[model samples]
Target chain A: MGEYILAFFMFRYLRLTLRDTEILSKWDKLLQAGMITSAVLLGVEIIFDSVSQYTTWFSYLLLGYIAYLIYWKAEFSQRKSVFVAVLPFVIVSFLTKITSLTSTEFYQSWEDVYDVAGVFSVIWMIVMLVITNKQNKALAREREKTLQEEKQNKIISQMKADLEVQVVQRTAELTKQKEELQQTLDELKNAQKQLIHSEKMASLGELTAGIAHEIQNPLNFVNNFSEVNKELLEELQEAQTNGDLEAVGDITRDIIENEDKIMHHGKRAEAIVKSMLQHSRTSTGKKEPTDINTLADEYLRLAYHGFRAKDKSFNAIFKTDLAEGLPKISVVAQDIGRVLLNLINNAFQAVKEVEKPEVVVSTRHSAEGIEVSVKDNGPGIPQDIKEKIFQPFFTTKATGKGTGLGLSLSYDIITKGHSGQIAVESKPGEGATFTIKLPKT
Target chain B: MKILVVDDERDIKLLFQQRFRKEIKNGEMDFVFAFSGEEALEFLDQLVHEAVLILSDINMPGMSGLQLLERIKTNYLEPPPVVMMITAYGDAENYAAAQRLGADDFLTKPVDFKALKEKLKTLT
Candidate 1:
């Protein structure tokens, strides 16, 4: 109802401003209405008449309209609040007006305005405190979130750096291992080449020596026969010139006899040379199941012949312990032949210069394989050189006497080629023994 | 019969000449000298068995004793003269190779004269 009254009064004021057609004209009407309402209410109360009371009630209606106009026009900072701040001035205006009307009854009207204003003011203070606390907590929460983000970013960067360093370290380690393996492989290839070359040279050496011995027997007879034939031919010429018929027959018989001898020895020489050529031409002859005892014996003879040609005084006595019931191994006859030849020859040479020259070749059967050993009664290999002997190009023999590749190549052939194992047992003075073991098939 | 000793080194030739002096003086043998393996081979090729034994030293600067030995054995099968190879290196592998190429005997140098005489006796 009071809001209705306020709307009515603002409309009348707006009419006055518009109709008067001047800004000052609206303010003159607003002041006139205020003074008339105040004076009319005072006169009615003084008269104590019911008819005038109705006219005085219009004054309250006018006050509600004026207050509404002022509330609408107010700024937040400069204007008094409608419900709280303005209530004090409004109570003061209501009191002074009532007091002018009835000076004794003024306290009763003052209490009504004071109650409305005081209640509104207390409500305003509670709302202000709540808004302030919420804004402050929001700001504090935003700062905490930003700090957490910074800490997360720092940790992530550190992890990235650590991962990069670890990757680099691992890559370097792999590269080092790769280089080391490559270097080892290169060295192994070089050693393999030298071993092959030495093996070829050794076989060629054997071929030549075999040829030399083979040719010697036939060549002798040829020399003897040709000389005798030449002598006989000359004598035959003399006999014809001198006219000795009987002497011619003798010369003829002598030439014929020498011719037979020539054929006999020449054929022997041819067969031997052909065989030596065939032997050297082929690499690692067809493998066969060969009795280890037989191979040992044959190579032992050849080794003996080879060494005897070099140094006749090196008559090292030989002994063999051929095991019975031993299995015949499938082997490349010539390759194994060469290995045995090298070992036996070395053994013989080792023993030849010793006080009592002696060599022993022995064969035995073991669970792993067939073991063949050649031992000598020579001054044993020095401890240092024993290990070195198995290395390519390492030799204990005097320079030019031994191509150190012999044993190293033998080791490869035995271990890698035949899938066998070779070991040496030696002492400084007792002697040395070389043993080769082949897996039992 | 006479055997020619051919080598570059004076020591090797002198050793051969001195070692066989007794047989040479007795008219049982005679010695001739050539300075190189080539000269030795040439002399032998000409005279055939006049030099029944050609003891040669390998490792000469030109035309090694081994080359001479090979030539002698391959070319002249008839009465192929006995060739004993001598070297400072008693390399058995070398010996085997020499023997394979038709070397009758092999000797390491600083040769004991007595051993040489015995080898010659077998050839004769």
Candidate 2:
């Protein structure tokens, strides 16, 4: 039972310390061969009683060889310290048995002590194996935890990369949208400029007939007087040829009067031509100090009459409330005139169909500068359209009747040209008032 | 031949008389003056068929020459006076309108009196 217990401890130590199971299995076969040799040697000693001592010595030697194989040859590194610690005790026990070979009692007592020490060493080996197994399990658990942390770290880095990609993509999309919006704004600005130019041409077309008619009067006088002078000159020559002093004097006096009349009409035509040229010229954008009241009043009547001349049935009640003692404002007169003309013309058009059509032009001294307003008692501007009224190409008038750039051009003149402010206020059914505030010099 | 000259400018009357002074003195040409289209229409009404030629301006304060041309074509059917339309501006629309109103000729200012005299001699 003791040998079997020792063999079990040796098997457990070999299984625990050997790196490969195959090496441990080979050690197992060698252990089995030594144990069978020991049993066969004991059987030979018992069968040949005459050679008992020799067979016993041989068995002892074989047992020491088996101990050397178990302790040194097999892979038992975990139990190596225990084996080294017990080596001196084993040698002392073997020496005690060898020296007291003739003293049977002493030898028997020492063998009993050796058997007890062997049992204690086997118990110590079992305890050491248990400790080594616990240490190995703790190390495996730590390694698994490290692997799991590595996997988590990889996933987190992948997520960070994905987030960076999304940020880059979003920024690119915003930049593209911004570029598209800027392009659209540029196109709109270009279209607005073209519309304003076309509207100006249309207004000039309307003014052409009135200007032509105005120039015709002076031209008629000039032609008529010149022709009459020519006939009078011929008559004066005839009177001189006939030697009639009284007839010659009358004819020469008539020719002089006709020439004076022709000169007067010629100057009138020149004045008309100068004014037309001024109207057609582009603004020099130079500032001049001018009376605000006179400027407002002149443009109002001009616009009103211009509309009336076009349509004979157009009748609008005109009213003015020009404030006295207003300071002169420095502005480009032609640009301001254009703004006023556009506003007044718009007012007249608005009130053309009203039951009590009225157009009121008011000028007054403001705290900062001068304020001019054109008000009309017509169907007022709607809320949705009021905001867009100053935008180019926005109009409520029928096609061919309006170019839709009048108010926009006016806005440009008042705001951008003169550094003034223009705004509109309206009650849907009452009327609309367009106000211009200009700076005083 | 009797002729009616219509224009808003009063100087036109003196002009016509001076240009045809010898003709008027000889009684070869008789000239009458009307200051506007309405006045010319009034003179046309009073004279009925006395005037042989009517020269009228297209633009006037009361009634345009085109309007007068329409009135003359409709009212003066029996031996209608040969009407010539005159305007300061020879615009296509006004020319077409004058023609549509049955004007005998279209003239632009300042009127060519030599051409007028040639046409007049032929008509007479």
Candidate 3:
């Protein structure tokens, strides 16, 4: 009966402790078979008292099966304690069975062995119950720890996902801001291009009167020479009709000379017009081999005459020291012409109030590179504002007289566009000289 | 009459010589040419009373025509030469300024040679 009870409890323990349901179910079926066999044997024992002797062996087989299940299927940690609890009961039973089987006399004399076995079986039951309770408590604590770790892992993953989302959002925002800043910069660049174009037009506007005067002089000559040629031709015809060879020769020479003068003056007028057109048109930024001396001379006269045309009383002795045999440099002619014009105009403006105002434009080929310098004998720039002169919108001129972008634009054209250098040297009360040095390359 | 024609244009000398060829050949009129106001003043300083009439352009480097006129009028008091100012700018301001500075006549270019000749004949 104890064996049957123990088998039932072992089945329950396996059901409770074993994680594999299939294995637990197998153990349950095995235990049921054992109990059914024991029930059958118990029935047989009643029918034939001789079968009672085999009941002990059947109980041993049941105990061995339980031991095998506990040893093989139970958790290694639970197996040791289970074996310790069952060992005393198993040994006591074995001893009782041995005494009963081997020595009938010893068995009758030591009938107390059955009582001892009973006491040990009770202790084993108590130990098994305590160990099961302890294992259950430990399992519950382990399960709680596992649940806590799983929850912490879930929270950490959530925080990581949030951080990734924040990173993406921040990156998106930064990219948008960068795009906006780039757009603004592009707009500003377009505005700057328009401003530079307008400045070029404005300078051309300033030159209009002077260009008119220059062209007018040549045109006047053209008209006058043509009129003179007409008169001379009429005189030559009259002389021819009169048959005076010397007078005819002289008159014919005069007519030819007048025609030549007319052609010369006409060409001059055309050149002036062409230069005016070149100055007014937007630069194509194409570099070509250009004579710097001729460019400097042309712009010097233009700026001088332009200033003189504006203020009739304005006059200065302008000189040119063009170096002979200077090699032509590769440059955008119109751009360099504009730079020269701006510098010469500034020189004229600086020397406006000075007595004996003189401006000198000179070109030279030096070891450094090709250099064009415009020097003036005027009141020089002070040291304080000298460094600021090349900055945009920095002008010492009266308002409305200057746009203040001349030097700054020139600086950009020479340095950024051409990879050159432009510098100003001035001594207070003496004069100022602006020099442009372009590289050979 | 000895006349001094002052202008910055170098071609003016050739043009004047050609225009006044008959007068020059016949010795009826004498002409002197100076390319700038300073040159004209230098010529006048050398030959004090040789030139009786001076035709000067108002715009020239180193010395303007008006400044030259002022100097000529102030310095040459005795038998001062008739000073005529010519300018491309026909503005009233220049005319008034020239007049104020003792310019005997003011003319705008392109100068009408016919009218100028008639004016010169009347002056003579």
Residue-wise lDDT of candidate 3 within A1-441, one digit each (tens)? 455455545545655665555555655566567666656655666678776676757766767776776677644345556656766776677777788899989988878868777696878768786986798689879988999999998999999999999999999999999999999999999988888888888888878888888888889888887777777788888888999999999988887888888898899788778777887788888999988987887788778778987887788989899989989889988899899999999999999999899999998888867999999999999998898999998888789777889999999999988899999999999999999999877
C-alpha DockQ of every model:
0.04, 0.20, 0.64
**How many steric clashes between backbone atoms does each model show?**
11, 0, 0
Interface RMSD of 1: 15.0
* lDDT agreement of model 1 with the native: 0.67
* Tens digit of per-residue lDDT, candidate 1, span A1-441: 222233343344344434534544646665566655555555555576655434544655665555565567432111223234334434544554466467645656576655565455445534543554454456557767777887888888888899889989988998999999899999988877665655556655754653464365357556656665776788799999999999899778767867777787788677555434544554544667878887786567556656656653344557688898888888776677668878988888787668657788899999988999999888888878886888977877688666787888789778877899999999878989999998876
Quick one: ranking by TM-score, best first? 3, 2, 1
Per-residue lDDT of B66-117 in model 1, one digit per residue for the tens? Answer: 7778888887776667778876557767788788888887887545566767
Question: Candidate 2 - CAPRI tier?
Answer: incorrect
- Leading candidate by TM-score: 3
Q: Give the per-residue lDDT digits (tens) of candidate 3, residues B1-118.
A: 7789999888888787777777788886688999988888788887776647899998777788888899999998767899999988888989999999999999999989888877
Q: After superposing candidate 2, which stretches have Cα over 4 Å from the reference?
A: A1-138, A162-175, A210-327, A354-362, A377-393, A399-403, A412-433, B1-124
What docking class should model 1 receive? incorrect
Interface RMSD value for candidate 3, one decimal?
1.2
**Stretches of candidate 3 above 4 Å error?**
A1-149, A367-369, A398-401
The iRMS of the candidates, in order, is 15.0, 5.7, 1.2
